[model samples]
Target chain A: MPTLIKHDKIMEDDWAIVEVEAPADGIRRIVPLEAWLPESGDGLLLQGECEPDARYCVAPLIAINFLVFSDGRGLSLAVLLRSRFDFTGELRAVGDVHPDLLYYLNRCGFDSYLMPDERSAQTALSTLAPYTDYYQASVLEPNPAHRRTRRFA
Target chain B: MYRYDSFDQKFVDERVVHYRAQTERYLAGELPEDEFLQLRLRNGLYIQRLAPMLRVAVPYGILDSRQLRTLAHIARHYDRGYGHLSTRQNVQFNWPELAEVPDILQDLAEVQMHAIQTSGSCIRNITTDQFAGVSEDESVDPRPYCELIRQWSTSHPEFDWLPRKFKIAVTGASVDRAAVDVHDIGLVVFRTDSDEIQFDVKVGGGLGRTPVIGQMIRRGLPVRHLLTYLEAILRVYNRYGRRDNKYKARIKILVRAMTADGFRDKVDAEWAHLEGSPSTLTDEDLARMQAHFQPYPYDSQPASIDTLGSQRLEECAFDAWVRHNVAPHKQPGYAIVTLSTKLTGVPPGDVSDVQMDLVADWADRYGFGEIRISHEQNFVLPDVRFEQLFELWQQATSAQLGANNVGLLSDMICCPGGDYCSLANAKSIPLAEAIQRKFDSYDYQHDLGPLDLNISGCMNACGHHHVGHIGILGVDKKGAEFYQVSLGGHAGNGASLGQIIGPSFSRKDVPDTIETILQVYLDLRHEDEPFLLCFRRVGMDPFKERVYANPD
Candidate 1:
């Protein structure tokens, strides 16, 4: 199972997220974000390294933490993770994931969006096809750039 | 006229398809509001106070009869049966639906027109003298150079996302009718001692909260290096212009922060880097663009225009119009006639559908079917025979397009402020109406002499109030609307920013304030002095003292 971290709160050893509390005894370590590489530990949760230099290594089975979706730093982070960093892990967007921003979040390569509940999560999926075409380059589609170049050429 | 070739036609056709797809995507919920806002604005669609306002670009203010008729048809079918001509020489429709904009653009593209780059942080329309090619005083036809600039600047990758919108204007004549000094970049084409056409470049001049008259940076630059030099300026602005604050984002602020000399050094450094870039203009390219704007076939006349001077003397109204509205044309028997839109009860630059159609017909009936929109918010018949003046005036008067207030106070330049714009602090159109209503008499306006009264709702100076002889600015004082009066501003061969008179006045007191200011000019003038010279002869102290001395 993919691990998830609430970026705003610190977890004690007994806090288990699935059981609504901390686990009694598991991996009892608080890894500072700078040293916590995706390859260093299995199912490790990380947050707050928005301008990561080496984000590509974490491409497999990593649950990134988004403190707030409206902050817009997360969108850039997600784009970097997908396009430049090539992170194809289970990209779950958590914390303040408004239903309105899900379309952009999905385009930026977020797979499983963590909203308030299941109904709102369905609402997020509905916003994905709001427009037909775009003029600028985006991560989800590489066709717009080609089409514009051919036309202007 | 620059006829659209296959390349130009295909480009606009493809753009229409592109915009249609974006509209579909927006309606399908794939594009978010904020993201779509940027996209639509780039296509000249603005979500104004009540509805979407579409600003249609009139490239360098030149249009033929078919284009004008197309605009009239659009106004009739899509808008409120009318359109407003803007000070930037574009036509704005106030009520285009958000979903119908793509179709609207398609219709415009059929006539070699598009709203692209009319809004957003890109190079807005490139303007030139309304009498560019036909003016007797012109050193060269500036339209070809303007067309070259348009091609170079349109959809430019590096410059599209500037800190703010940029404007460039060029004038080939010595008279400076294009108001080049108030633009972001201004070029004046003149022949050097060797008879080669050269450009004098001016940069970082604009009208806004900080109104500035541009300073000349390069003198007698050869015409070949125009695009290269422009690219240099844009690169410097894009890389270092302030983006942290929108108000301080224009190149003027950046130029001001690092004095003009320092800015010139930086631009030179940037030009050094772009010395051999592909964006540089080639002689072949210049020739190709020049071929598009070749002079029309003219039939030489047997008689000079002065032969009809005696007939105008018999009709006083036509005589006044001939003196004020007619400009010297390069052709012997022809004149550039400015048909003022500033009638007594109508808003400045507001032309109904019928009026638009009539003007289109007049263009065909008078000279070549070509028309131009002046920066002063008037229409120009670039070629009209001097003998046809009375006949054209008769038709224009019947259509309510023959107002003889071309340079008078009633012909004010106003912004669509509080009524339409979301950023306006006060209403501008109504204030303009109040001023026009007070000065409706033709005799009174004629006696007042040539005066440019400009109004802006806010300090952004969309109305270009800073360059008016009598400038009125709407100010918000503690949530209440007020008017600030200024005098001595001029825009022409000689340009200066107006100085604020004193404390602001209530909206009800504005018309009286203007009357008092005009009275001061009338009382203190020499026989030959215009309003500007009179204001300069006796400084603002006398006008300011007279205006605010009696508040009641």
Candidate 2:
């Protein structure tokens, strides 16, 4: 079994990802965004294109699935969910989560991602820590680059 | 030339690490090909027909001697011994492994350079006039503003993933050598009577499948509002620009759909929110940017050098080289020498490693150790003493870099066509070569005078074919390649797109057709009237009739 990298830690992911929403087995089952009930302490599942505006209200945890899609709408959606909607809950990126998208996903909002295997997951995690500084203000940093830089005298 | 501070240096370092991770993920099979393509392209790496082509940015076409040597080192080590100077003022290496691109970016970062936004759908390298600081006609130098825009646009988070690629060009010179009118956003920088610098902001000008002359939306915008005003235009474009079809995605299509006036209204509405933002340029910021471009310490030189005069009187080649290749400088007795890369048989902008080293050495010897790359695909040494002209000309000729054709017919802007680029419809280099060989005679080419002949392999218009005095476009007809001819195009002051003369011609017939068009121009033009001015005065009807007269 592949080790899951979540919140900078390697651990066994127990949450079962599912498509439909309904009477769930408490927080163990991650259901579709539509099935996410308010304050029920349910985990919500999101398609790459699913809007995240209402996720902040109900879901205790949200997992955005990277659809077998070519473009990167999922990445942007994750970024917007955190940066715009201020979704502070445990965010997970699943489905066809390419190893390369992990660093960007981490920057965007995702605290965890489904990797193919343990070795690949560990390698992907290593890529994230190399950049000691970044240009843009993101989910990692709230202040933009202009505010971060030293202004000319 | 601009110097990098700690902030600039650190940003590049971080960017290299970021791109390196992206490449590592792809190599490790963690990132899929499609996802990695976007990341790699933004770093100026493209998978071409033969091999991967990596484009390294030279911001506003400016590079110092150290940067040039670093480029030479990269070209020598990472790529083949030569590099092609692109029309966008970036250097393209046709052969390189994708795996080594991050390493290439790392090397570039050490020199305060990165390939960020050189490709992909975002703001590109902010281009400016090649003679920006030293031009005699410029009232205020545009290089500072160019630097300001470049810094603001790099790693721009919001606009990184735009509907289509965006280009911005600035020019402070009276003559628009930068071709500002054909850019996505054209900033015409100038000073008011009170000596305050301002910009006449023009938007939605681009050359591609659809060619356009950018409409001036805002006139005399104060320099203080530079970043905020640009932010306004980009926000509007990002939100409203079409994304449905790639062909119709450029800002020009958006501006045309909503008339220029309507687009201006939208931008005005957007600007209202950003006008007083913290991003606005402060006096200190302006001074800091300007400090990097302080005037060179020029030694007063005689108006005419005795040796140069004697050489000119004796050797016809030296006289022709000076007349065509050299440009007048703002500083007295100094001249800007253009080292033409458009030698016969060679591609328009291809320069070798030894040549680059030679030019870098010459820059240090004759002037400031800096170089500028023109969009016309030539190198410029901005400061050279009058006395050094004859000697420089002799050395340059020996290197085959002394084609005394700056604005002449043979000095064409040709793109790397089907041979290297997958997007090309035909080969542009061969067509340029055929035309150059036909008019190789210096006397004939000089007599033709000031012809902006441009050829593009495809409708992407990388060569800016639409703005050429005589534009030639390679069109894909069925499964075969054909050439399309256009007339009366010009990129400067009165910028206009060339009108198609007739039906597309076979590749073999292109040179003859151009000859016929020029023949008609020679017959019709008044004394000392240039080819473009004459063509504009009479319209394409005259040339059109003659070229198509013997058509089957």
Candidate 3:
């Protein structure tokens, strides 16, 4: 219904979201990791639950729900997946994705965001660009300032 | 005393800009009220009853004179020439405009300060003993560990939102001035027999409506596991602490519902995953932070008892001041001076612009230019030379900060209650002043000896009424305000919450009620028994029966 942000740009949505119990329609579709089959790995999108522990089973597209603007569970999940699992998949953040939260979400290793329109996505891009450095460690920078600098290293 | 490296400087500066943008969006009405509330709170801006009150983080209650002068300048320009030092050792400005808060934060950033995580449901300030580095009884300085926790928790990715506000207090001193029993997660850094720095971790202790002493969850946790252990604890709390009701949202409630043993199991399970991550601090990191707080070089000098005795002979007031206000410093020939902000007629912890500037000057002239804000709401010059005590006392007197009531009954811990706080049940300043007026005699207070009389306008316990020897809490009866008295609570190595004496009394009768309680202690106490000891020796029955018996 709307364009998805793939690799930081609004891209055409060819894949459709399908339930785990859906029949194999031979079309590319995003499904939960629990129901993913080896035969469907060629042209299929996959999602994981919001919980960090759910990432033991890998997926191409691990979707985490922001749920609310203030809820930080999704961001923490993304960070844990990236830093702990070294996950190299498209971490898609959907649901209640406020424009202002884009910076923190991007810092926590979310590569794609689901926004309602291209204008909102473009507007939210500016939020991710500022504050090039931070004091603490995140997915964007695995090493904290102490380790990077010789003062404490 | 922790100086900002380039990374810290950049982080704080970026936050100043980020908060400014948030303010701009808020002013444009693009962000809704509910969303802006959390965002503003993260920057320590509060929409109080009268105006916007900003609580700036004073990390571990440490500040240098330059920062103090910056605060004075902010007060003079932005506020009504005064600021309130809160129980958590942060400073609060009650009358700053919403739009100007960003500018205030910008100014604070220039001084190596930011209000990050001072409010919100995230981690608040990491507090400790005001006499952190210099206390004689402290086995080790807790500031370095506090600094470590401050950095780890600052803008942490996972814990930016929590079920409720979290607080952490650390102390290495056997005397628990940090009030470890009344915090979310309290740390006591202890050295093992082999000289390894380890921590005794306490969790789920808090002091709102349902106050519970913290349970010691982990003992002898090595220093390397500090961050991992804390991360484990916070992860457990963030994932499971109650968010359904604001009243039952603190980790204490969660720990209670899960049972402390069950909660420890959950934390241990979480720790198994997070243990020994990159967050595990190295000894080099600890040493780097420890180097910031080395004792200042002191010139060798012979004892100046004769000169001090001559000054003491000049006036009895100065002698009394030295007796109460001055404390023994860890370093020889030096003393720790507690400049009393508890002068009768002024609200406890409220310092004016001129007083701030003067105290900053004294910090520069007499000590190492560093100042400490005690949880008891007084300023501490941590390294004053004993020879200069007289001049320091004289200069402090000119600023109306010369009260000799360090541990006395008149030195009460109070909150900015109904006058400024929207959540307060009644006015606390007037009540504090009434009590101070009654107990104005220094000799009487001295005879009382090391008494803690704390007041809170509501059950929030911001005044720390739960831990005071004679705790006064304001209650609401129908439409009228009333005060309740509790006894035997002391926040120390032997920490215990005070039990309510009896039925609540009228606001006007609080001072008299306290007097009656003190009389009971005075009559029952042996020659030198403190109020707390006397109360403990003869339990709450004697005082409770006497107070309820004469329902005045």
Model 2, span B31-59: residue lDDT tens: 76887888788888889999999989999
lDDT per residue for candidate 1 within B450-495, as digits (tens), equals 8999989999988888999989898999999898888888878878
- Cα lDDT of all candidates, in order? 0.78, 0.83, 0.84
Docking level of model 3 = acceptable
Better of 1 and 3 by DockQ: 3
What are the TM-scores, per candidate, against the unseen true structure? Answer: 0.80, 0.88, 0.94
- Whose TM-score is greatest here? 3
In model 1 chain B, which range of ten residues has the least summed lDDT? B273-282
Give candidate 1's error at residue B28 in angstroms: 2.0
- By lDDT, is 2 or 3 better? 3
Q: What is the lDDT for B316 in model 3?
A: 87
Give one digit per residue, the lDDT tens place, for model 3 in B1-552: 789877788888888888888889789986678888988999899899999999999999999999999999999999999998889999999999999999999899999998999999898999999989898989989999999899888878678878789999999997888999889999999888999999999999988898789999999999989988998888788777877798998999999999989999999998987777677888878888899888888757736546699899888889999999988788878888999999999999999999999999999999889999999989999989888899999988988999988999999999998989999998899999999999999889999998999999999999989999999888999979899888988887878899998899998888887887888899999999999999999999888776767555
Which window of 10 residues has the lowest lDDT sum in candidate 2 chain B? B300-309
C-alpha RMSD of candidate 1? 7.9
Decoy 1 TM-score against native: 0.80
